[model samples]
Target: MSDKETPEQRRERLRQEEIKNNIGGNLNDSINKSNNGNLVDLVGSLGWKGTGILIIVIILGYIIYSLFFS
Candidate 1:
């Protein structure tokens, strides 16, 4: 902010400040995107407990669908 700062430096500093201010939103987006990766990565990230729950839900859904519609 000093008068001694060059224009390019000022621009770069402003850009960095803006990026810092926006980092919280970016972090949340990154976490959400991480879960949306390929199937294997998503499952691995969730670990065994999450994988078990996901499989249980799928099996229950299939059972209900077969009973009701087929």
Candidate 2:
């Protein structure tokens, strides 16, 4: 993260970052398979009515925040 890092240090940092990302991706894939596809599974469990209400609430919250802050 520092500008003073040598090339070897940067390379090793990137290698570690890639390893972490690969492990995270594998874990995410396993979880998605078990949970039946992440957001799709969530919306399905909520059903149409619950999903609609969620969207409405999110939109209203955004609008209220914008009105007050911006």
* Best candidate, TM-score: 1
Over 1-70, each residue of candidate 1 has an lDDT whose tens digit, in order, gives 8999999999878755654566555444444757666666545444455557768989999999999998
- Candidate 2 — what's its lDDT? 0.65
TM-score, one value per model: 0.49, 0.46
Candidate that scores best on lDDT: 1
Report the backbone clash tally of model 2. 0
Clashing pairs in 2: none
Residues 1-70 of candidate 2: C-alpha lDDT, one tens digit per residue = 9999999999878855654456545344544554756766545444455457768989999999999999
The Cα local distance difference test for each model comes to 0.66, 0.65
Q: After TM-score superposition, what is the CA distance of residue 47 in candidate 2 from its true location, in Å?
A: 0.3
